[model samples]
Target: MDDEARRDHRTVGDVDLTTWRTRAGRASASAWVRLGDRFGALPLLLVTLLIGIAIAAVCTWVASEVYDAVREADDVAVLDRPVLDFAMSLRTPGLDTVVTWWTNVAGTVGMPIVAVGFLVGFTIQRRAWTPLVLLVAASAGSLLMTVAGKDLIGRARPPLADAVPPYERSPSFPSGHTLNATVIVGTIVYLLLLRQSRRATRVWTVVLGSVFVVSVGLSRVFLGHHWLTDVLAAWALGLAWLALVITAHRLYLTALRRDGASDIHRPS
Candidate 1:
């Protein structure tokens, strides 16, 4: 036998290490794919459920902390002073106009229009039911969570005297604009990433997604509509929800692949 072949066949205590390792790696990958096909959703469901619980825990902690500080009249620099100062520091005619414009664009009326336009466009292009269902369900769930959070907390908005024009009356624990924008923009970005195989396109899509979410959240604070904690909590909650949506969709794709279904065609 040739030296190379003999070396490949050489056994270490009756086991060929190279061949064993090769088989082991392939077996592992195949098992993973099979698991994804047969039970792909269970893991995602469990992880998402845990994340939802963590989100709830975090929100509860923030609400409790804020409540304590208010009741005790303690000045907590971390929670209160820094963000307020930052907001106040940015006050100016030109920047105020710009930020206000952003808030309006990312707010209730504008974001919905953007989200619906993408939904319709993607649905028409892909001709798939999965994306439609995923978007609708995620949007509805986000709305419900936002409303419930505001109502439950019932925290007052920043003092009217300190706030900018066109003040909001809703609770300020979680920013609805932040939460909605995160879910909508995040999901759209995910869909876009799935459609594109190019590295540059994926990178840009992620960057744009981050910019959209961050901008909306910051605008809420800049306009004095939400506290920093409010925006932070909204981000955490929104991310948790986004993870769930992405996981569910991946599970669907895995199942489709397992069943020998044709892959969903993406526009180049």
Candidate 2:
């Protein structure tokens, strides 16, 4: 046999089912599609990845510019006083008392709870450790990014109309509430989508997750802990990260399907 053929044969060493399953799941998505579908799906995946990347880049740039412009203003009065006034009004012990509770409690504890929930669900259903690994990776990555963002941007929070303590000394360019909301809520939503097959479950999960994210962002502003731009930037960053992760995850799943491990797609 030729040298290339010999090398190929050598690479075909025996592999355990578990190892093979992992190898397939971790295979390059574009390559898998090319091998499986005569390069047709490869082009589509590449195009989709490019489009996603472009959109994320545009959104990130826009968010940065918007936050910078907003931060340049020396006085709050420069913007319509009503905008700030409206946000201030929501801080009263009504209109959204639940929001206050959720925001305060969630910003403190909800993330851990959600993380545990995802872990339990994954263990019970798939019995695979990969989902847990992904969750931990997402959490660590987001936390580091948030700290780095705060340090780099260093935008100040708005002056409180009422007494609202700053729990953390950090920049206000990207709201931590928004960032955490994005990661916690977004991760939960992603995991739920992967696990649940019912259309209603998917719809409701999107609605609930969207509401949670938006509310947390607005709460940060209303509580006088962050500027509107901060929350907006958080959303931009969160969405960008979520898109990247999901796209990568999809590629991984596709590779798994290519292997004999067809059971990977059995309704989560």
Candidate 3:
């Protein structure tokens, strides 16, 4: 759409490219609002971000520290029984095949599938830029955080010392599968809820999200790539990340309201 036509069509709740720019511009302006109306949101968002980082950092640090301590302790032998028992409980050939297939689906194709869906939203609404930016940011942010966490913790993988030809050589404090699944699925759900408020949409989003999160976490265990603790930590970290981002997005919306931009992003 041409600039003038786009601008003319933009409304307060719109989800098109122009509305996205309007929303972001409103957000930027709201960030710098001189009046006291927005004083609360900015600091609160910053604090939320800081708190998330702190939690992730502390958990990661503690995990690494504990791994070393346990490795050297005589009680290390005590852990083997429970770990083995847990692994045994998950040992079913049928489940393994299913998880293996789903794992491949989630990792190789799920993300791109989500991205393409987002692109459809962008195309239909002529808001190509907004979803594009949001998805790209989520993807980059998820990857960077996972890699950094892996490097920082430097925890060893599940000990398959002799059987594998080549194995993942990174820390396993938080499973990358857990991270990617949470972020990608979380982003899709969040965006869908943002754009559509129907009861069925909300219910389906919740159901789909719950299933994806649980299945992905379970797949990590079935694949023998992560300890239960690692998947748990990843879930915690992912939720914390999503909460911070949502908080920021809402704060930006509030800022826009305070900035006298009422007609900026209405859905057509």
Stretches > 4 Å off in candidate 2? 1-28, 32-66, 69-82, 94-97, 161-163, 166-168, 259-268
The global C-alpha lDDT for each of the candidates, from Candidate 1 onward, is 0.67, 0.60, 0.59
Q: What is the TM-score of each candidate against the true structure?
A: 0.71, 0.68, 0.66
Of the candidates numbered 1 and 2, which has the greater TM-score value?
Answer: 1
Best lDDT among the predictions, by candidate number: 1
Which regions of candidate 3 are displaced past 4 Å? 1-84, 126-128, 161-167, 258-268
- Give the per-residue lDDT of model 3 (tens digit) for 1-268: 2342232222223343223345665554445333325354335445444554555556556655675676577454465336645765766678666677686656646767866776686556754344554455555556656776788766666776311222455677678878778876787777666656466877788798879888888776656677766776678767766665654444434433432444334423
So what's the TM-score on candidate 2? 0.68
**Order of all candidates by TM-score, from best down to worst?**
1, 2, 3
**Residue range 124-176, candidate 1, lDDT tens digits:** 87765556666776686577668767876776777777778888997876788
**Model 3 global lDDT (CA atoms, 0 to 1):** 0.59
How far off is residue 91 in model 3, in Å?
2.9
- Ten residues in a row with the worst lDDT in model 1? 259-268
**lDDT-based ranking:** 1, 2, 3
